[model samples]
Target chain A: MDVAIIKYNAGNIRSVDHALKRLGVSAEITDDPDRIKAAERVIFPGVGEAVSTMAYLRERELDKLIAGLTQPVLGICLGQQLMCQWSEEGDTSCIGIFDQPVKQFPAHELKVPHMGWNSLDRLSGELFPESLLGSYVYFVHSYYVPECEDSAAVCNYIVPFSAAMQKGNFYATQFHPEKSGGPGQEILSNFLKL
Target chain B: MLAKRIIPCLDIRNGMTVKGINFENVVDVGDPVELGAKYAQEGADELVYLDITATHEGRKLFADLVGRIAEHLNIPFTVGGGINHVSDAGILLSAGADKVSINSSAVRDPDLLDRIAGGFGNQFVVVAIDAQFKDEKWTVFVNGGRIPTDKELFSWAHEAQERGAGEILFTSMNHDGTKDGYACEALKTLSEKLSIPVIASGGAGKEDHFVEVFQEGKADAALAASIFHYNEIPIPELKSYLKQNHINIR
Candidate 1:
């Protein structure tokens, strides 16, 4: 299967590509719309500031291109946040694909960025196979998508927030499956099979 | 309910799992991938791999080891040591690390923390603080506890939080490997002071130590090396004990 990872000016795309390679699947990393659209599956993986990242995607017109893809498009970390309606990081507007707003963690005694391995409270979705239900996945995020119509999985830190979402062909996760171990790889592998 | 965490720390030298006290008397434990898998099955909440010799020839080996562990393990894992830049963080995360722990690098350039947190999101970035009791204050140490800084533990922790650090893995160098217990006072103070979760490392001798760290120190998690490596404490039983003591663990 041809797996295309959307490459913008972000830090972690190579790793995601490497992960796919380890899974014995060849993946192409690109920002080219035609290449992404042509692929059997697409992954938008990134690690950077939301606003600046969106700026880069917008400048390259990959934003519109990503929104238009018909194949299954998976967004990771910042990519997932950017797929939401808006982000409070820099008061930025996002792709509005998930119809949800990304908001910052409440400034309380709890940490702003809820990092480390946290378990998922499965809501309802076939996005995660039976092997992944109630399993712990790695997560590192400060802003989170509030529980909305599309939430497929939820995790609680200081409060509950959407951990994974699926809206038709556009599926996104706040957690980095590329970083998460077995459960993460399973999720990615499932996405690939889909 | 938030599930508690159990993390096993593996010290690696030349890509082989090793253990020692005060960073000396290194002894090979086992293959990192095997050990990691063992921990996962044993109900360990997470696993940590620290490259003791990450300076030169061992760096590539560490990455390779991470790749191997990532392939087999189903639980979360963390990698630390010799991570100096944002790119380095990217390398480890890509290699299958659930989170990247930074100590010396974060101390040298505070902005490095912000840049990493901004790029990777704060959740992937862990600021590990190695502190020692000195002059009636807990002082931050760098370079694997070889260099001491004037930064106070509390202040530096606050700065790390503000800079977007997702969690604070605090290690009391003085209490490390002492089997006495965690630095409860230090942990309690920091845990009460910061909103971010505080992981207490060093000085866990027995299962009771884990309970004490949670009940008294109020640590979000407890990390141990020798006890777990030497089979002194099995994680499943330890967690069972904690649960019996009315401490939350998973």
Candidate 2:
């Protein structure tokens, strides 16, 4: 499959590239909208602050291009957050793909960033299956998308939030499927099949 | 609820996993990559590879091995020890390292924390502090615990956080290799003082010791080497024990 990873000033796209390569699919990391739009599949993988990432995307005019793509696009971590309408981190506006605003996890007995392996249940969409229910996937973000219509999977930390979201041709995961071992590989494989 | 992490720390010397107690003993427990995969499959939340090599050649080998390991493993793996420049971290990150930890170098240039946080994200930079109790106070040690610094442990941890460390890996030099128990008192105080997650390292002999670290020490994670390496305490059994004890574990 011809896959392109959106390159911007965000978090590790290389890891996503490597993850695909592990599954025998070599993906191109490109900021050029033509390359991304032409690919059969596109991945928007990121790990950066929302405002700066949005600025990078908007400055290069890739934001508009990404919003226009009809191919299956998988967004991971910060990519998922930016796909939302807005984010509380850095108080920045986002691409509004999911029509939900991201907010910081409420202050509770648990710490922020919610780092480490957590269980993902309530599998509800094509990106995941019943096999992944109650499976432990990795998570390391403070901001989360609330339980929305786009939510494909849910994980509880400070509160139950969207672990994975699917809207039209766009599928996103607040958790890093690229780094979640075998289950992670399965999620990526499922996206590719779509 | 977030699960408390159980991390297995592997000490590498001359590209081989060695015993934490003695540097000279190059214990062929197994290749680090394979061992890391084993632990991950058996339910280890994270893995830390501490390359104790001081030579430039060893750093290259470590970086290359990290790439190979990253290809096979799908968990959060931290590459630590002997980070001289910011580019070193970049190289590792490109090679698929989730996070790069620096102790002596971060101590020398405290601003590296902010710089790394700005360049990469704060979650990608881990500040590892080795502390030894001396003169009635815990003092920071650098250069493989060979040189003692005037800086106190508590203040340095606070500074590291302010400088943009996502997490602190605090190792108790006095408790290391002893396997008695973790320095729970110090860990508790450090966790209470800092808002970031604190990973308690150094001494872990039994499963109960891990229980103590999470419950009493209040550590977000606990790291041990020989106990897990030697099979004295397998990760699956340990995790089950922790679960039985009402500790949140994956």
Candidate 3:
């Protein structure tokens, strides 16, 4: 399978590529629009600041290219955050794949970056299979998108939020499956089968 | 709520894990991929591999080992020791490392923290502080604990957090390899001072020590090498002990 991970100067791509390799799928990390457009499965994976990443994506016209992709497109971590309408991280606008805005997690006796393994429930998306319901997956994020019409899975931190969101052909996860061990591997496998 | 992490730090010397081992099937316990996979299967929340190798060839072997381990394990992995620049940090991150830790380099060029946190995001940059208590203060030590610095451990941890380091891996030189106990006093001070997570390294003699670090020391994570590597403690049993003691651990 020609799995292509959209690359535009972001972190954590290597880990994602390596995860795919473990599943026996060699994903090509590329910025070339043709390759990304022609890919059987597209993954938009990133971990970085919102404004700068969006600026780079805009500079390379990747924002529009990614939005226009018709295949099974998966967004991860920062990629999922940017897929929303806006992000409070840097007061930046992002690709409006979902009609939601990403906001920073509230500091109500909880740490800023909700960093560690957490359980997922209310799973109801192609991205999250039944087996993964109530299973633990690694999550590390400060900004989050609250539960909305597009939420496929939900988790609670300081507030109830979308752990995984899907709309039509586009799917996104607020957590990094690449770092989430066994259940994470299963999540990726399910996404691939979709 | 984020679960408290248990990290096993293994030192790499001569392109091999130098922790004395006695596994029959393991020809060389230093094999990075084998050990990493083993720890993950055993329920280690995370694993840290520190390269203490001196030879240049060993550096290449270390990178190759990281690549192999990244392919095998399905957990968060962190690498540190002798990383001097963002480019070097980039090398390990590109080799499938989730986060790259900087110690001596972070002390020399403090702004390197900003650069790394900028390039890799704060979540991907970890600043490792090796500190020793002396003269009524926990003093910062760099260059593998050979040279002492004027920076206080508390202030340095606060600085790392302000400079956007995702986490602080604090190794207490006074407690390291002693198996006495974690520097709880220092850990409590650090946890109270900094908002970022503090990973307490050194002085883990028993499973009860892990509980003390979390409940009393206020540590976000506890790290030990000797107890785990030498089979004095097993990851699963230790986690069960922590859970039994009412500590939230993955």
Best by DockQ: 2
- DockQ of each two-chain model: 0.32, 0.68, 0.66
TM-score, per-candidate, Cα-based? 0.87, 0.95, 0.95
Residue B133 displacement in candidate 3 (angstroms) = 2.1
What residue pairs clash in candidate 3, if any at all? B17-B30
Model 3 CAPRI quality:
medium
Worst lDDT 10-window in candidate 2 chain B? B20-29
Candidate 1 per-residue lDDT, tens place, B1-250, comes to 4555778999899989998876778788779889888888888878888988846779999998988887776666789998888888888877767678999889889999998887767767779999999779999999989999978899999999999887899999889979999999989999999988889999999988888888889888888888989999988899889889997555
Q: Candidate 3, which segments miss by more than 4 Å at Cα?
A: B20-28
Question: How many angstroms is residue A12 displaced in model 3 relative to the true structure, after the best TM-score fit?
Answer: 2.5
Model 2, B1-250: lDDT tens digits are: 6789998988877677777455664666668888888998898888999888879888888888888888777788998987778788888888888888889999898888888888888889889999999778999999878899888999999999888888999999999888899999999999998878899998899999999999999999999888888899999999999999999887
TM of chain B vs. native, candidate 1: 0.97
DockQ of 2: 0.68
Off by over 4 Å in 2: B27-29
* lDDT pick, better of 1 and 3: 3
Model 1, native contacts kept: 0.37
Error at A37, model 3, angstroms: 2.3
lDDT of 1 by residue, A157-177 (tens): 777888899999988888878
Q: What TM-score does chain A reach in every model?
A: 0.96, 0.98, 0.98
